[model samples]
Target: MNHAIFEKNSLILLIGTLIVVSIGGIVEIAPLFMIQSTIEKVEGMRPYSPLELAGRDIYVREGCYNCHSQMIRSLRDEIERYGHYSLAAESMYDHPFQWGSKRTGPDLARVGGKYSNDWHVEHMRSPRAVVSASIMPGYPFLAQTPLKAEHIEEQMRTLRIVGVPYTDEQIENAQADLLAQVSPEAPGGAEMQKRYPNAVFADSPSKAGVTEEDALVAYLQHLGVSVDFKLYDDKANIR
Candidate 1:
């Protein structure tokens, strides 16, 4: 019953600790299975297209997550500042998830469609040029660096293995989609649309071919624009 008794008998202490820990873990984890079903279903929540996924990789590679957070807390200020509060379904397909902890810059959860592609290109090239008071470093190299997407198919296959929902057709056309997103006039526009119905195809003037800037911009433009919150009751989905 006392600490001395448990310490005196190692076997008994081990057994008793395991029993206590198991009970505590079950108490915490058992309800998750049931509660998962009760999560509110929202419309327009779709997985990131191959192009967006590639851009996401570039985002992570550049340590953008170090300054920005993708998750917006369910708070009054956050909702007012960054549209509706973040939803679980918004990041359902994110492998490691980019719900960062720091806020050196503003939250980028709802940054998609918040600015034009040209504006983003300018900002990335020279953050101070766009925002005089900005402290973020410029990424001019992204525009100059050509995007390498030869392994895009393999990347999609790997993501699919990890629950990203990439289909065979999507994997097959990953390179084409990546090119088409940044080059709207490209020949694969039709194929890209067929594979990713919700994708945005636009011309990026930063590069003749696909550039790192194009990929990063594509990923940034997709931050929190997936779900259409207009149809949902904002008051009801605050949590």
Candidate 2:
């Protein structure tokens, strides 16, 4: 065998490896940018509240990212299975986005207000009660532990730094937004009334449990509530 022929073959192999790696990188990243073009059409998108942001951080820190993805791609099976594919703007505020590829559990991009506080507590305590045959372990610690509210402002600051639009002016508006959507007949509404039946203060902030602190619960409870197959198409109506 010629030594020059062997050297030439090695160079060819190195070039091939670089080409393959480059293609793979582009394949993985290109779609995300394309998806950004579509996000311009999404409506009613907003930043997570301080407490909800805290809960999301907790969700991530607990390795919940290992099991769930925050992204819902545009696809028939994903729409049919998960209710609606997520929009690009939906997760625009997330740093290093939680759009995981592998889902050991479920998609939580829209898990807001899907269940009750008690249910979250219960599910965290024991998954089997809420989800029969769930392989996931219970997070009893989150329930026994009262959530630390110290980082409320700091968390909001972090979200704002990233891109969340929450501001001091928006707090009152957020409360009004929740009130308009929430039905007085709803289970949580009744509980809210029992506590702060009337607006005692024009801008004093809703009761401790009725505002953003509890908005985290509202977010967790409202998951999968927006997409109603009977109401609208899951895909963006953007031209």
Candidate 3:
């Protein structure tokens, strides 16, 4: 039998509706808190270094997420095309993860180490030049904009406050590490490597100094290449 009281009163309808919505929300979200295996235990997944973090910030500033996605779904087609499906552990340290919703560009989950740094520079400067059918707009100005790294340490400190695993020494050396990532011959390059073992340095293609383009490229090149898939059974992690 239907409850005539619920239909006859607005306040009763609002309360009943809120109860339904809250139950649905709890059903969806509550399991994550209780489930210990929600995120996989994987090896070789490290947090982003100071320079990579700077590049990630620049990526957000450029609104690259508007067109690109960093995640790869576990469907067979996605695995065939993008190498491996993305892991929750891979982005566990991201304050706001970059698993974008759209794919105007291909999924960037495993784009790291797939192309040379020089190719990335040319493609960013003129996307259509490298991929003739590409409709993406060019970002030539990124190469011209000198990287202002004066506040990089402050940025790292802010990220540390949010649980990004940045150490005191890492935050203190943020500026030098940023410069060292683009200038391998710089005096601090050796120290930077000791701090961030996978950091790669490449000269800016357009300007004399390290530019925003350098940071973005460095960030892109480090994507989806952290976890060593050889150590785990691919089938076990597929989700």
Candidate 4:
């Protein structure tokens, strides 16, 4: 039988399996090589600020992706509920994009600017405090724990090596920016603001030092805000 050939000849089976897998991989990956030039970009899209990047790391570390998805599907219902559908250009800088397929909580594609920082803080401390039916757990400790940002520059440097386009100045000032983002009147914040116009500078009432809460809120407030969907031309992406 055909099965007997593979079962008896281990070397032949190994070679045959590798050949099949290679062919399958080639079929899946070759199209991307051919289509790389066809990629389109929208305006106002920029790399995440240092604070937001740190928050994104915390988001991943806390397994927030388990409950929430960042991707909004093209379906009409999804678009209506979560603003415009997600754009490839929006996720271009993501080392591993967060376009997850789970929906234990709502999609977060357009959650930016939807609620105030205070509301987010309250929600984070206890979701049910604001949303009575919420099943999400509280992260009260986030506000108490100071953000560990001394190595932010090194993180930015590593991201640059992976094609994030972080400039030398950005990497050099990463730690400053992280601290500046949580203080509206911080002297160093002026440069950070200039570098990131969309970045929100909030004053944390409870803590003098920036905390994990501040970083995560910054990241949440930065999502789905890079580009103006009204100005976007959907046809340009079709190839």
The models' CA-based lDDT, in order, is 0.81, 0.56, 0.82, 0.85
The regions of model 1 sitting more than 4 angstroms off are 1-27, 33-41, 236-239
TM-score of 4: 0.83
* Candidates arranged by lDDT, highest first: 4, 3, 1, 2
The superposed Cα distance between candidate 3 and the true structure at residue 102, in angstroms, equals 1.2
Error of 1 at 152 (Å): 1.0
Report model 2's TM-score to 2 decimal places.
0.60
Q: Candidate 1 vs candidate 3: which has greater TM-score?
A: 1
lDDT at position 197, candidate 3: 72
Residue 200 of model 2 has an lDDT of 13
RMSD to native for every prediction? 4.3, 8.3, 4.1, 5.3
lDDT of 4 by residue, 1-239 (tens): 56998999999999999999999999988898877544476788888999999899999999998889999877777776787878888888887788777998999878888898999999999999999999999999999998887888888888889878889988888888888888788779889988887898756767658899999999999999888888863534534
> How many residue pairs clash in each candidate at the backbone level?
0, 14, 0, 0
- TM-score each candidate: 0.83, 0.60, 0.82, 0.83
lDDT of 2 by residue, 90-180 (tens): 6666765778878998888766555556566567678899999888997765544544555456556666776667666444333443443
Model 4 ranges with Cα > 4 A deviation? 1-38, 233-239
Find the candidate with the highest lDDT and give its number: 4
Which is superior by lDDT, 2 or 3?
Answer: 3
